[model samples]
Target chain A: MSETNPPIKIELVSDPMYLCGARELVSCIAHRIGFDDMECSKIALAVDEAMCNVIRHGYERATDKPIWVTITPLSESDESFGGIEIVIEDEAKQIEPTAIKGRELEDIRPGGLGVHIIREVMDSVVFEKRETVGMRLTMQKRADRPEEAPRISSRSSCPIPAERRVS
Target chain B: MRERPIAARAGGFPLSNDNFIDIEHPESGVCVVIPRHDVDMSRSPILRSAIKDEMGSGLSKMIVDLGDVQYMDSSGLATLVEAMRGAKNANVSLYLASMNAKVRAIFEIAKLDAFFSIVDSRDEALSA
Candidate 1:
């Protein structure tokens, strides 16, 4: 049902103020695409984190740089299963795809929390150097799972695998 | 200012200089800081500053009332972390209260929920 939807493109400046509008738009689209409340928030958060990174690190906080956001639907044919795909493109600084590694969540005072959230919430996250854009960060959140859905802590009562079960 | 729709829903508070945060000191030894809008990078500094002022006010406990806030990004989270550290050094306990599901999810995603004392209600926060 969602694949028939057209892609939505938003052009914004490298300013934090624009983030609110972008998040609102993304949420509206995600909702229209049948994402539940929690699913909508996770997808919106993934896009928010990406834009913040581009504005802060990619553009060095310059307010005039251009940031492009494209939202498209994911389908089983696309191997995304089912969800929303957010593509954030920046124009100022070229980023090494491999350099986008998220810092350890164990570290309290590190700069990678944004990256970590992007990774953990989204089912698939990919970064690439686009021909026209300086960098392209593509993230997809499957409608099938929310970030809080799968988190059963080590202390949970779920049956443990015998290989790693406490003896 | 621009917020507070018609009148104080429950109560009112004084806004900081930048007008980004509303600080309510309901009683002695406790301070409550509420941001009037979305807590993003641009506005986190104002909140951080307000939190700093409260830290030095000799309050024994500080509560960040998140009931009014709908969205909070990473910068906002970092501000709270820094405030937590400052509160510790200043002998003030920092508590986060009434976070909506979205804001609470942000904290959980960052794995910092356990790091902060998050309560479901302001009364719970006040009494705890």
Candidate 2:
């Protein structure tokens, strides 16, 4: 609200199936804002991971619970610091972030890797647990990776008719 | 209606002849030659089980040749890592050969390229 050109728009939903849709929307937003493929992939993966946690870990198949997701563009100052801000909130359960530590490959059991993947892919991951409420997770990612290319598909070869080529 | 989990094969094991070819060697053990396309999350579970079944058949040394694989994702990487870990836990050896740049990028991103031994050819994966 403080002097940013167009205040970033927000989309809120409480449906589980919207999870996949949300990922696509983030990718579209990233593209509109000029984020590279790797950055877009990172955001998509982060969304999948977080939503998986909320669905599997927090609600445990209880579809009656609701999850909150907020997307906001960082202010000029925040952009200077790096990336967009994504916040996901859930009032289903209050769980400590530390409880979701990465297990060694030996202990690669099903259902525990989601939270670990979320923290690893995102640049900064913060988890807050409120009393008698749920947990909020905040994440940041750089809109651009210096080492990554612009993501033009390398296979540029296309078949052309000889008659068309002559023109 | 609930979306059925992706079924890799119909009334058969996960290793479809379309995606993998089984090869066996006396000295090096059994190897599965991965095909060129469709090596994504949908097939990872089947790939993992195929590797496990091969290991269970007393083929300690295993090789996965990704010479033709053009794309891979995190779940694919996770499957490969799990296969490698499974081999180690079972006291067997595992190797990969001819990883393409796009598929290899996933390994690099997952920081697993350094953890696994990769070679250029099937023979190399078998012998080394």
Candidate 3:
């Protein structure tokens, strides 16, 4: 009965603080869509980095300009791969997808690390410079155990292993 | 104009070292000195105190020098955002000075370029 449902989408305005807000937003939305805790953290980190890049380089030092982030979660039937998908769009500046290179944290240079972090955390990261407007960033995450639907946090209430029976 | 060195406490780090954070309020109200590298979650606590201490002294205008910062993560950006908010609440105006393209990039990504005043040099911030 649930196989024909569409994706869930969310939109938010971009701000300097949005970097942090993006992380929180992804964590909540991903959990609501059934992603585990670790998966949610990874998505949040990726979104944070990508939005940071849009806020920085693409916008050309302008913040008043509008930057939009849209998130859509792909349902299980369509994504047998067992994960979630999110898309972020900004009408600020444009980024050259070809020019983006992920940086090694060990290398630690300044200019270009955000894109690298985004790629590192997300299963699939796609960047497209819209014809004349801004840019679109797409990210996907795959769940290892969709059935279990692992709890986001693992701190169980009762500190009882199977061996410690009530009897 | 006397220059005083203030180590970044809780609200500062990565952008300025504990030993290198400096404040120069010659004609300008306040100036913040930043270091070259290694700013992340662990060092943010230091920044808070540095800014708070400066503001406590009644300095209204500020310049944050970031000539040396090579890398800054979300934690680093958070510290700055908090400081910006703190400064505003205290009626103090803050400006970022001498940001490297990399560090400056974080500001742009965070959309902070719209909220704070930034300049090419400390002198620029001081004069403004």
Candidate 4:
């Protein structure tokens, strides 16, 4: 929330093996933020998918490339509701943010469900291609606490915008 | 990096001493795989390759035991879907057994719970 309370940051190679560590880190953060078991698991899963996309699509499985993750706790004023924000940064070939789409569920197959899963679990997903190189993916989820209900944004109520949704 | 038999392809890439997965042949034509870690992008490849090898060997009935798997992401789900496709092509019956609560939730969220044959235990899966 402030400079003194910096977000948790983790840097790892683009290798898939680090994905497990990433998942564990996010899961711990989600639990510390008061998310329930189910919510924590979903958050962890969403974060994992986002990282996978960066490693596989953005970095093209180049294990030497670096991937950075930052998890910040958000206050109510940051958005209509208070929750957590996960930022994934990768220095790889830039991809069009709008072009990212997951495969249709009806067409059952492998390798395309990452985007869809992230979209489903998170309250909002935003993609931005960095100026010179790399891409940044930000996924936010509203805390499901009763006290946070009144300030919840109408936008946050919808998990994913239909336009950007894959499934 | 090291070459190992399908039996040793557990845990994930780089194959740690932790044994992330285990394989068993309960009966002829039946193979059971138990994953001991979270099935994400890092571990899905191991699962895919193992199932592919089983399909190649003409195994007709495959059961995946997810009782020990506490987490699974889309990549893991995609691996299962790919395995399903391979099984269909080989005329093999692929079943999922003992999915924990967290793993089951993901399948339900993706609406894949209806797509796969899910059972409470390996015995039920084998019987199904």
Compared with the true structure, model 1 gives a TM-score of 0.83
Evaluated on the second chain alone, the candidates' TM-scores are 0.84, 0.76, 0.77, 0.86
Residue B21 error, candidate 2, Å: 11
- lDDT of candidate 3 over A13-93, digit per residue (tens): 544533555556667767665665555655676676676677667776464656666665554554463456777787866
* Model 1 Cα lDDT, one tens digit per residue, B15-100: 32245667777888888888777787666666776776668856899899998788888888998988988888888888999998
Candidate 2 Cα outliers beyond 4 Å, as residue runs: A1-23, A61-68, A78-82, A98-117, A130-133, A144-167, B1-29, B33-44, B58-61, B65-78, B89-92, B97-110, B119-128
Pairs that collide in candidate 4 are B11-B20, B11-B21
Task: Give me the runs in candidate 1 sitting further than 4 Å from their true place.
Answer: A1-3, A76-81, A145-167, B1-18
**What C-alpha lDDT values do all the predictions have?**
0.76, 0.59, 0.61, 0.77
Candidate 4: lDDT of A151?
A: 31
Comparing 1 with 4 on TM-score, the higher-scoring candidate is 4
Each candidate's fnat: 0.56, 0.00, 0.00, 0.78
- Between candidates 1 and 4, the one scoring higher on lDDT is 4
**Candidate 4 ranges with C-alpha deviation above 4 Å:** A1-4, A77-81, A147-167, B1-12, B56-58
lDDT of candidate 4 over A1-167, digit per residue (tens): 32223688889888887787887778766656556668878988888888888877887888888989998877655444467889999898887889988778888666677788888899989999987889999888877765642232323332321222596
Q: Give the range of the ten consecutive residues with the poorest summed lDDT in model 4 chain A.
A: A154-163
Error of 2 at B18 (Å): 12
lDDT of 4 at A58: 82
Judging by DockQ against the true structure, name the best candidate. 4
Better of 2 and 4 by TM-score: 4
Q: How big is the positional error of residue A92 in model 1, measured in Å on the Cα after superposition?
A: 2.0
CAPRI-wise, candidate 3 is incorrect
Isolated chain A TM-score, each model: 0.79, 0.71, 0.73, 0.81
Q: Per-residue alpha-carbon lDDT of model 2 for A42-144, expressed as tens digits?
A: 6766775676567667777465677776765553343353346678888767866777666554454333455556666777788888556988888776544
